[model samples]
Target: MLSIAMSTLRERWVAFVVSLVALALGVGIIATIALVMNSALTGFPGQRAALTGTVVLLSVSAGVTGFATVFIVASTFALTVIQRTRELALFRLIGATPQQVRRMIVIEALLLAAIGCVAGVVISLVGAPVLASVLASSGLAPSWFEVSISPVPLVLVCLGGMGLTALSVSVASRRAATIRPTQSLRESAGDPPGARPGRSARTGWGVALLLISLMGMGVVAAVLPELATVPVVYLWVLLTLVAAVALLAPALVLPVLRLLTLPWARGGSAIGTLVRENTLTMARRTAATTLPILITAGMSISLLGALETIGHAQSVEAGERLRADYVLVPEGGPAISAEALDRARKIPGVRIAPLAPTTVQVTGEAGLADGFWGYATDAQRFAAMTSLPLIDGTLEDFGPGGIVVSDIWELGAGQRVTVTPDGGKPVQLTVAAVVGDSAGGGDFYLDVSDTGPRPAEAAYVQAGGEAAAALRERSGELGASLLTKAEWAATVGNSDQGTGVIGMLVTLGIAIVYSCIAIVNTMVMAATARRRDLTLLRLLGATSRQAVAALLAESVVIAAAAMVLATAASAINFAGLLAALTQVVPGATLAVPWAPVLAFAATSALLAILATTLTATAAVRTPAPLSE
Candidate 1:
């Protein structure tokens, strides 16, 4: 059996080679992500603790990193498996038995997995100590992190990754199996769509998926009560992605190609014809590449929307509850000081109302609010000036030591919640009515008296945007911040630290891999199809540059149209995530990060052009097609 398997693989080495390479890249990606995140987070707690000895930051950072990584891994794996269809099909055609083919694929994946795992461990081992040393040198703490490698988790990670690879390879193998053995004599290998599966099965999958989406959304609406809108919305949008990718790919390409003709179709007849002609010919491969992009765009956009909504909501909650023109503070960043407030109240356009601010650590599993101390005063008239709505418990609940909170905190209502106070125990506080004050963006609020006589100073201030600006200008040397509602909106909305840079990095990282591989494959396939055509084009007076342009123009059309689909998917996804956020985060509102989306889309398009520019070499200058 072993001899037969090796002999079969030798004959069908192309598919086997392709499968191994694809699987290696995917498994390597998964293992690397795990390795990177673990290495990054492993030292995070120790570093932060060394600096401040505050354990809370450790939890918060760890939570955020972990949550984002989970989603990133999912997106990466899904993209990886989808790109290996042709290679998988080729394996079945090479006289390898189905079981043997499967084993070969699995073994290839395992080899890659083992290699990736070892590489990752090596990275952590070598890199962690260096990072710790740097932190110590920088005066951060008890002088660096201990070198520790928890073998158990790494082993588990390897096992889990291998399992995913096996499963994905198995599922994708169906495409290969559909190719009739007799067809191997006539065709090179099963292409992107491969052998068409039975219609009934496709229909069954589409219908079942649609139904599941509808049912899931309906169930979410029924079970989550106040949060019903959110989950339902998410379910609906996710279904939209599934349905579009599954049902639309094969049939929709040519139609979209014709549509691309509308631009140059008016006058540049040659360009228009080239664009349409190219797309019509290469839709399947283009569509396959475009599908993953659409999903990522949708997911990223949707999640971004959720985050924006939550931020705005929190702001409104904070603004509505605090009505001060200025948060008079001394020289420090978070806590308020008496000397600072006295000077601030003397400033122009400054009406200091019952000034109050307290340093209290919000303890929640989700870290719903920003990492900081909660501040409160006897309601801001400026907040009223900004039109922050009081949807729940009144601002009247706010007084010295009597605090008000947004309605999202109802979880701890009427119960003693432990909080780290500036100069006291983890005091327990009674629940106050949760309210929406998105205009101010406050995560938590506290009464002045709750401050417990540590100091007589201003922690918060309320002022109009103009007034805030004037104050900053006149006393820019005061070394403090004074922000109006509009400024705050733009500021909080734009803060980079929320989703953090690492999230985008991971997304782009996987996307780059997908784009590179897919482009290479497309070029390879296109070259094969257009061998004679290209030779003819070269003979017909087209320069190498012109040929490159034509190829890129084709790529641009495909990428741009696909990006639009991705954008639309993202929009819907964002709306769904917002609905979920509405229930989970107080004052959560939908936010669309258009700038990032556009930037990303533009980059992908450019990359596509570059891809064609580099790979078009085969068609640009070669007159004779290479004979296999």
Candidate 2:
């Protein structure tokens, strides 16, 4: 039995190759991500110390990016495995035992997985400082960031990935085992493997998951509010997306059918009729492709939402907290002129209240070392006229002997701290309060009289009523500076919310298209191989057109069904991924935008129409002779 199974591999090497390649790609990504994450964890501290500051948000960027990277890799790999169905079917019929099939996939996958791991580790080994340099230039990171892949985890990642690759291949191979040996020995499996979920069935699962996902989130949030926030939100989006795919796919066919039947549609009813009929035919193929579409679409929702959230944090939110409508500083300060301030005041809705201009040395938290930043403000006016929320201490804290720091400034309320403001005297101040800040960036609110860093001073002003445009005009005229709440918001809106979503959509769109092409090619080949059968049908008086339409309708049906299943799967996995991300990334939330989901479903339906039409074109041209 073992020999027979093993022999089948040589006979069907291509099948094993497909699994190996797909599995290796997945393992490679997993290994690389693991290595990077480990290096990130290990190096953050040294990097932290070298760039020591008054505070650090230990839970932000590193964790979040890591989690996202993992999901992107996993989805990519799964899609790859699914695309190569033909090769797998052949091996089973050739007498390959499942165990032997599994081994062949694992061994080959291991080799490729190792190479990817090595490449990732090496790149990280080399790329850290190039990154640090860019950060330093941008004034974001200090000059002393230590970036390198440490020995411990990097090695572990490589080892672990091989194990994981083998495991994934083994699991996937077991499913292929159910393929009837004789049937598979003859030809490839259908584009997608399954049938459609009935409306009730899809709805039941969709509703169940939706409820469970939501309930789980509510419970988690009520119990662990902070941790649950981003995680719960992500799960919510994931569930919603799944339900949309499930509950929506069957319903999707009608729209596609309607689209094909539309009076104003591009092609005439014959082409359109054929297209519509074919859509119902390759339902399985369409559905399989929809899986990738769902991933891409679902991810787009999250990415866009993230960008929007981040952008909002940078702009509208940042501006509201800035509190100062305009700032007027001495010509000698950071250079805001009186004319600029006056012009700002002249703008519509402009109102100027008070100004506080003073200086405080900027130093790292706990006096860790490095350079300094200067804060210019008059304590009394600044405190009274700002939107800064005193979450912890009080306003009395903003003095040479007292202070309030940003939320991320990891210090106890009563802790005493001393720092040489701008390389000056190490003045000690007690923590009075910690103020709330909107954006994740760091800054301090304290009253200190020091001029250590660049003098170029900055003056704060309160202005209302259309002061923004006036400030801009004045800045251009007086050669000074002004930034309005809206202008400032636009400038700082880094994530640009939905702006980046197009890229994700395009990428996903391309993937779905590629899948469609694969389906077309597969169907065309299958039809070509069945020329004798088709010829017999043609002889039986089944018109080539009708035969083509029937085949197309079958494809549409199967693809549609697969699409239904995929939608359901997307909900499950996407939720799991979000939960993991929430555990890993700080402040990362999952939000599903309905528009994108609907768009993807519709897109899949359209592609199925295209694929079916294109696939039938080959067979319709010539009827094969019936005698086999």
Candidate 3:
């Protein structure tokens, strides 16, 4: 069986090569992510909170990429087995038992996986350092962070890759093993059957996955609404939906292709007819090719779109929360000088609220021991300058002896919590109010007297009409940069957001690269496997140019279907995310990064076109064989 598997692999190297490459890329990405994450986890001690976001990002990336890898590998193996239907039938005719056939297929998969995993590990050796640098430069990790080389992770990844391949092949092999030799031989002479035995089962699984995804979204929206903005939650939901779409892809391919190719199909051109018929006749192959593009386009749009939506929501929320007419920020220092605040307050009709940002250590609660960020300000003036969402008590209750804590702390009104201010002694203060979590806002608020003599980080001024202009001029004279409420909100919204987005993009880059490789590999494999069909077209009086054109048109149809399905997936993901966000951040709108999405779609289409046309052209140029 091993020798037979080796011989069969050599004979069909072109098809197996695609599977090998896909598996290799998958393993490489997983390995690299593992090494980097291991380093991040071990390198940061006592600063885990600071590295929490980065680690989460890495974990999500690994999970998504791993899912995609398994999916692509399974699809590749299924297609490869299906394409070898005739060969497998011949083996059965020669007295090979079903068990033997299955064993041979498994052996072939293990062989391919073994080689692929080794190559993948090599790829990771070079990729880890580069990825580490990206994380450090993006500020997601410390500059001193480095990938720690460990044989344990590498060995485990290799073994895991092999195991995954074997498992995927086992499932795919069942069909090949069960098919009657005569039926397979007959089917191989023409287009493979469109409907398979387990199609209903596949549909059931797909529907079940989709239902699970929706249920998850509903649960998040109704319960943990704050998690809507968390990338891992939405990303997992998106990938689940993508998997459902993938499972249902064969059923989706024909209908979508027909609609997408309507103009070309209705043109009464022979090439168009051939293209439509070819893709529809081999819907499984078309679906397989479409999966990569679907993943690429869907993921790119969902990740980028979600980031934009969340960022925009935060920005809008910030602007809406402030009732101030102008904001004054110090130009050259961390804190605004008392002289600047004095001058700003002297302006007539202007009420100023100076916010002194500081950190405080809490020794009472178990989790609160890491210290909390808060602001010291004149409670009365602060209440007048902003409309904070308060869950308990009122802004008026916030005074010299009282503190306002975020609801996240679970501190209720009138509860006493001991907090030590930076450079100050521990003091117990009463929680006068509990405010909802607001982005870019402190976790707690304290009166200036309780927080020592800290200077204001920024001042909020409630001034309108001529008072606003006068305050702005006065701010200039004091060498402080003055911005209107809208301008300041925009600045706050944009701050510290890019680091996260960049980190996510860096992680997503791995998946995108793998998807691109899969796209090319699948297209080339699909095209090359159709040498017989191309030869038939040539024998039926079609020119090489016509054959290639038809193939290219079919590739376009598949790419179009992929893009359409990807758009739907992304829209579904965005809708679910927005539903959750609306529960947390009211009036959250969808933010689609159309330019990047379109660019990625175009690139996917172009790769599909080139791979199909180039491979089809070569296949058609070969003379038809006189016998099988």
lDDT of each: 0.47, 0.46, 0.80
By lDDT, highest first, what's the ranking? 3, 1, 2
User: Compared with the true structure, what per-residue lDDT tens digits does model 2 show for residues 370-487?
Assistant: 4423253445556655665567767655655665675556775767766555435667777767755334223564453432222223445555444555555555564545544455
lDDT of candidate model 3 versus the reference: 0.80
Clashes of each: 44, 48, 0
Model 2: residue 536 alpha-carbon error in angstroms: 9.6
lDDT of 3 at 108: 93
Candidate 3 positional error at 350, Å: 11
Q: Model 1, poorest ten-residue lDDT window?
A: 53-62
- Tens-place lDDT digits, model 3, residues 1-628: 9999999889878779999999999999999988888777876686665566667778877887887787788778878876777788888888989999898989999999999999999989999898888877866776667788777889989988998898777666876686556754573443455555227556678889989988988897788777766555667777788888877787777789889767767898888887777777767667767888887887888788887787777778778888878888877554687677877788898888888878899875456476788898878788877888789988888888889998777789988988899879888899889987454478898888887756787888888788888877677677688888888877763444224566667667778878888989999998888888777788889888888888888888889899899888778888888888887678689987788777878888899899998999888878657346
Off by over 4 Å in 2: 1-98, 111-164, 177-288, 313-316, 327-381, 406-415, 418-426, 436-444, 447-451, 454-460, 463-481, 490-492, 495-628
Number of the top candidate by lDDT?
Answer: 3
Model 2, C-alpha of 28: deviation from truth (Å): 9.0
Question: Residue 393 error for model 3, in Å?
Answer: 1.1
